[model samples]
Target: MKKVVLTTSLLAIAAAAQAQSSVTLYGRIDNGIQYENGSPQGHKIAAESGDWGCSWFGMQGSEDIGGGTAVIFQLEGQLNTQNGTSSGALFGRHATVGLTNENYGTFKLGNLGAGELQQDSWALDPQLMQRYAISTLTHGRNWPGIANGFEYTSPKWFGLTLKGQYDLSNNTNWNSGVLPAGQGRSDAIEAIYATGPLEVRVIYDELRSTQGNFNNLYAASRSIMGGGTYTLGPVKLWAGYQHLNAPQASDASVFGTDAVSAANLPGGVSAPTSADHEWGGAAWQVTPAATITGAVYHTNVNHGNGNATMYTLAATYNLSKRTFLYTEAAYLHNSSTSNIDLGNDSWGPNNYNGANNTTSGAGANNPDYGHSMTGVFAGIMTAF
Candidate 1:
């Protein structure tokens, strides 16, 4: 009898303990087909994944530690649903553990979303900087998440919230002079205001590295961005601007507007004089189940590279609360001396950069620079 009573008591305690914490599993799967023209390799058509937002699977949970405090954790990873592969990181997208307090705010450690992505770019852009048309057209392409990161998010006060992030180069004492991961460190600070129908944001981010695994010797990149949104009637309007500067460094080349990966500038070259970007867009909720959005993006690259512009129109139809169908078409214009992705980052087969260059086609991957590219894709997405 005593054993039975003890068992019942322990089971009750277990149930109570479980009630203090909860873990939920969630994810989104997105896939689509795309068509493009004016790539280095000419025209193409194929299926694509993550063209909207990267597909992902993740779990988040929190345990109440005590009064007004909780311990929180999240594990999220990218999924290539079409290829059945990972986004290359075990938890490449997000891997974090943190503490949250109702009044104190939240602090997190480990890999997390970068500043431009979490703080600035997403807030100002209508597309949330996805792999779509506007994303390619904007200078936010440099936005990225980082490893060895720390982030702080402050609670809102008077409609204002502040966030900061630091990425440790993880070098031994931030080793200098062309060391692996010589970027030393990166940082960003952002402020956001939200109330009723108005939202505003300001952000500053920078990167410093020498041996940043780029074709040219690494230097530093800095950016300042500001933007806002207003809600009026059934239409939501957004506008924003970004400026980027990459100066030439001793014994190193300047960074390009597109990318500096081992693939972009194999032999390395001088960076451009400067780059400027501007954009504006609006979303109209035409019905309870549908929305139409359009945006125009432009960029000017100095050093005689000329100008690039992109126009995109997209629509979404909701089949249910958790599922939606979307279609979008984009037109990108590249001056004879300038080549920018019409699909944003890289659409089409061949990839290109700068003004009027061509490269081998990667089947259906990014398009080369120096050519105008146009593309359209329709896809379905679901969240669970």
Candidate 2:
């Protein structure tokens, strides 16, 4: 009888301990079929792993420390669902530990999701923030993330929230000797608001080369952007703009010019200078489990680069709360001096081997100026 009593007492203690902590595992798998036109090698079709959010799995846990405070940790990784392979990164997506306060906010250290830039994009895009569709066309794919740094997110104040992040060089040799190739600092600041049917955001992000190179060529890049969304019933509207600039290249870095050739560039045959981008979109919740999306994006670069424009439309039908079937179409039209491809988010010829000129180990391909691209894709996604 005494032993039974002791066992019950120990079990009660274990249950209490478990109540103070919790962990969850989550994942998503997406796959689809895609086709594109205007490829340098001609038309093509293929199956792809997809949805704007890459296929990934993650685990997160939290421990309550009393006093409205808790400790949190997460580990996530991207994977290719088509063939069951890692995205070449063990935990390429995230590996973070942080602290959260009920009234104060949250702070994190390690590889993070950066600022609120990505969340802001969802409001300003109708395609559910597809990476290659609306967002990439307007904003260059330069989210460095917090590789070796910290992030802070403030508690919401009347629908307003603030987030900031800094990426540091993990190296120890700083003031004494030569710096590493990518050993510079990257940082971002963002502000966001969400109130009933309205949402808004502003963000600033920058990266600087540590080499102290000359001629501003690939020396640094910066982005300043603002946008918001408004919803009326089942329909949501979005609008936003961004300004981006990269310093000019020097004589020693003239080879960098080859990276941005006539085919891919707006006008300048050299490295990127400054560019302006604008975008808008609409999302219609046609039914309780179905949605339609459409968006338009445009960009103009200095140095005779001219401009480029892209249009995208898509639809999603939910099989259940955790699964869906989707179809989408996209088109890209470039000015006489600009070369931008379309259907990048979907897959196939349009993005991989379009009309751009590229060599082995060369920079990304550029579509031929004045050329047009179009594509369509169908896919499904499931979350667990």
lDDT of 2 at 344: 37
All candidates: TM-score: 0.86, 0.86
**Alpha carbon lDDT of residue 281, candidate 1?**
92
What range of 10 consecutive residues in model 1 has the weakest lDDT sum?
346-355
Over 4 Å off in model 1, which ranges?
113-120, 138-142, 173-184, 211-220, 249-270, 343-370
Candidate 2 lDDT (Cα, whole model)? 0.67
Pick out the ten consecutive residues of candidate 2 with the lowest summed lDDT: 346-355
Taken over the whole model, the C-alpha lDDT of each candidate is 0.68, 0.67
For candidate 1, the C-alpha RMSD (Å) to the true structure equals 4.6
- Against the true structure, what is every candidate's RMSD? 4.6, 4.3
